[model samples]
Structure formats: C-alpha cells, structure tokens
Target: MKFNQYIFLLFSLFFLMSNSYAEINIKKCKANQGDYIIFDEYDSQIAEKIIDYKLHNQPEKRENSIIKIFANENSDDRNYWLASIQTDNKAEDYLFYQVDQNKFTEVDQQQFQILLPKIVECNQIKEVPIYSENFDAD
Candidate 1:
C-alpha cells in the first residue's frame, strides 16, 4: 500500500513539472517602440508599458494610453504580431507589426469592432452597460 502511494506521488510531481514547463515555453510577443501587454491564463494582468509619440509638426507629445490588451495572435512566420489594444476614451484598435518587414499599421475600425466581442470573450471580461435616468422639472 505504501509503495503504491509513493508511485502516485511521483507521477503527480512529474505531471506538474511537465505542465509548468509547457506554460513557460509559450511564445510571447515582442514590442519595438512600444511594449506589448501580456496576460496570464486566468486573465490576470502580467506586464505592460506605455509609449509616447509626437504627431508630425505638433509640439505636444501624446502618450499611448493602453487600457487593456484584448488579444494577440502571431503570424505564420512567427515574425509578426497582430494585437488589439483598448485605448483610453476610445474604441479598441487593432494593430499589426511585422518584425522582418519593419511595418506597423492600424487595422480598419469596422474589422476591429467585429472582433471586439471575441476578444472580450477570450479575455473573460465582464462587460456591463450602465444607463442613467434623470427626472428634472424646469
């Protein structure tokens, strides 16, 4: 009986070690000028960085306010990253970056909206709409 218990414990430890290694080997997205947002399997925030850029001919520099990271998908060649970022006070934006091509572009708004629900679902965000009702006599 004691020998059987020992064998079970050893197998459990081996399985846990293998699973931990698998999670550790997941490929993470690499950012160039700005940093990419990373999240864990439980939808907990991991790492994030904000970037600042100035508009052409504008003196004021704006900070890229990233509220949340919706999703990140790697390209077939593993040289590009397609991600959706929710900006402060604005709709979610889709971004594509190619490492080899050295290209970065914002995808269309229509496509971004279409993917919003999927992103929210994957991120396990509980979205709730709030409505305010006002009753005033003038």
Candidate 2:
C-alpha cells in the first residue's frame, strides 16, 4: 500500500511539471505602482516569435496588438520584427523585438518602413459597446 502511494505522488509531480509550459508572467510595474495589466503569456523557449496576439491592457482592456517577425512577413534577407501597439487606427510607434536563442530582447525599429509594403492588411479592432443593465428577472 505504501509503495503504491509513493508511485502516485511521483506521477503527480511529473505531470504538474510537464503541463506548466507557457505560464503567464505578470510583474508589477514600478511606473504603474501595481497593476496586472502588463504580462507575458508565452514561453520564450517555445512561443512563436512570428504573429502572436498581445493585449494592450492600458485603458481599454485587451486593445488590439500583434507581434510580427521578419521571416513571417516574407522578408528573407532581413532579420527584423515590430509590434503594433494599438495607440490608434494605424500603428505609429512600434515596439520592436529581437529573438536570440529563445530569448526575446527589445530592439530599436529596424527596416520597418522598407518592410511596410509587405504587410497584406491591418484590420482595425472596434470596441464593442457595453451596456450596463440588470439581467436578472425576479
């Protein structure tokens, strides 16, 4: 009976470790005091550096934002990427990044204007109207 219990405990630990990949990492920004807005919900080791959803989390929660890699955008000769921070309709300022051996590092805007034409389309995400009314019928 004791041997069976030990085996079950070992299996549970192994299972927990295996499924913990890509857990979200949220750190309080000293600038913001303490807010759960900024977070990284991807495993740098496995998350695709190309074309991933990113939440704005500033004013309007989960504002439209996306990350793009150079290769993913069909630029074979260049190694570059940029993020579209939904400041407004068109992304004016970009949050560029560089991936080095599964480690993501933010870099300056490089080759963005040159690669601008390569983009197929940039869809605008409209904010859905929220109505505050009672849903319970007594």
Cα lDDT of candidate 1 equals: 0.36
Model 2 lDDT per residue over 14-126, tens place: 99977654332222212223322222343231223332333322434223432232222122222223443333344534433433433333323443443333332221111
What TM-score number comes out for model 1?
0.29
**Tens digit per residue, CA lDDT, model 1, 36-133:** 33324422211121111112222222233333333332112234333444444555555544445555545556544544444333222224111001
Over 4 Å off, model 1: 1-64, 67-77, 112-138
* Minimal lDDT window, size 10, model 1: 129-138
Candidate 2 TM-score to native: 0.26
Which stretches in model 2 have alpha-carbon errors above 4 Å?
Answer: 1-56, 59-61, 64-79, 89-91, 101-111, 115-138
lDDT of 1 at 13: 97
By summed lDDT, the worst window of 10 consecutive residues in model 2 runs over 123-132
Q: Estimate each model's TM-score.
A: 0.29, 0.26
lDDT, residue 116, candidate 2: 36
